[model samples]
Target: MPSESPCSGHADVEGKVGPESSGGPPTTLHSAPQNSPAMAQLLPSDVKMLLLMSRDPGRYSTVTRRLWGHIFDSLVVGSLERMALGVSQLMRPQALGPVIRATAMLYFHLCPRCTVQHYEAALDTFWRPPVKPPTLVFYSYDDPLCDTAHLQELLASWQQAGMPVWAQAWETSRHAAHLRQHPLEYRHALITFLGRLGLVAPTARL
Candidate 1:
């Protein structure tokens, strides 16, 4: 059995989403029914690896950051900020032995089942959908991780779901390096987006 997060143990139980909170969106849960030959045909190896780890909780520490990093970087938004936030969330002591950390990471990568699903569900629940907040999604074509088609689909889903969304794509920038790569442009986007949300004056300077 996977160890539960320090704050809660109810995440990623068979059918539950998470504990009630004023947090973010409900996560899309996935269930795995043991090892099956058909799984090989149904999912790519990487997907299968994630699914397997999702079912187990012990792998959370090792896999959670990696998987999230991939997803965030692929989106090409503020990937660096996202990564930094991820590290801060760990909040563990440096005194913890490297042997322990390395062992945990190794097991997470090679473990037969996924235990990270609990963390995923918990993390997702940290961000609830805004009631009526204006939203902007910025993406980049040069981001190697995110597929343009998938990003379009995601934005379309948000729009169809009634989110006040503004989507923009850039021609160049490394993953999550948008602000650094194009400071003026990035500030403009933020200023425009915030103005739409009524959080700032249209002429405000950052």
Candidate 2:
């Protein structure tokens, strides 16, 4: 079967669209997706390979939970409340500042009860083991959004489960922007992976 890379996120799997090259036999290059692990959960049966770039696995690893929890809290509680809390903290006396600010930040923005149920439900649906396929991951240690340690752990789990997984990590780069930051290395990694899968000509150059 012809290989396919289905990129997904907020849109359902059936709605995913891949851009194809114009001059040659149709060749799909890329698509946008919100989360890699979540997308893997919904991959079409015919998809023989997966490529993930700078996305969380949607599992509640310690770091994943903390990062996503903060995001959910911010969305649910709103920015005005956060801003007010910040301003109020600055107005308070300096002697009690650190303790008061920490308390206020937690109270105003890190309250899990407000979003825990929804978060759990989402994770439950998105955290399933990926269907058997060779997987490639691109990530950076310095990305503030997606934790590198979490990816390492997740990749290890996948490998232990006997999944074929390959990863490339950089010390510094913008999230989802590795290609722009390290073009030759990124292209080499991608082409090398696809070539190994026999999805592209072994000598093909992007």
Candidate 3:
């Protein structure tokens, strides 16, 4: 028996897709079974390793930040944020771990029975649709995947082209992986950036 997310212990869980939801988006992350052997065939081993690695605390920094750069729409959006901010919502850190577990259960619940439906559903909806934010994009000047040219392009697009984003380049491969590698530097940059936005100090647990 796999462990459940504290958020996933419900018997009749369903999620509302907006801020006004008396409840959250469906508590379950419905997906195909894990043992289908189908997703294994579909996802290349490297990508599988990367995704699985993200679940492990030690492995979070292996992937380049450019990979996570593209996501912001589907998973983190108005509807979900609204529900997440609801007064009765679960505590962030406490609920997050179990939510992931419960979602794994929702997807792989039929593993021994040889089903692939839920897995495919998750795959289809994996990528976030296009949306921008008052975003701060952080990259290092020397990251191989996100080199000078990419940074230049992004700056031009965001600053000159009126794109809704802000960026800062560190001297390391500190994109998404920065927090894992250099905690202090990451903290300073983030806190300073947020301070600029007048959101100084922890207003609430993010």
Each prediction's TM-score against the native?
A: 0.45, 0.48, 0.34
Off by over 4 Å in 1: 1-132
Top-scoring candidate (TM-score): 2
Local distance difference test values of all predictions, in order? 0.41, 0.42, 0.34
Across residues 1-206, which tens digit of lDDT does each residue of candidate 1 receive?
44544323233332221222213432222211211112122122223334334545353333332221111222311222232332232235645545444544554355323423433342232132222224465667755434566567656765676656666568876544566777898778777766665556999999
True lDDT of residue 152, candidate 3: 59
lDDT tens per residue, model 3, 62-141? 23222222211111111212222321122336456456445444545545222243223323322221222244555555
Off by over 4 Å in 3: 1-132, 202-206
Candidate 2 residue lDDT tens string, 21-87: 1123322333222322122222221121121111233221222222110000001111323333433
**Model 2 TM-score relative to the real fold:** 0.48
Rate residue 44 of model 3 by lDDT: 29
- Model 2 residue runs over 4 Å out of place are 1-12, 17-127
Worst 10 residues of 3 by lDDT: 71-80
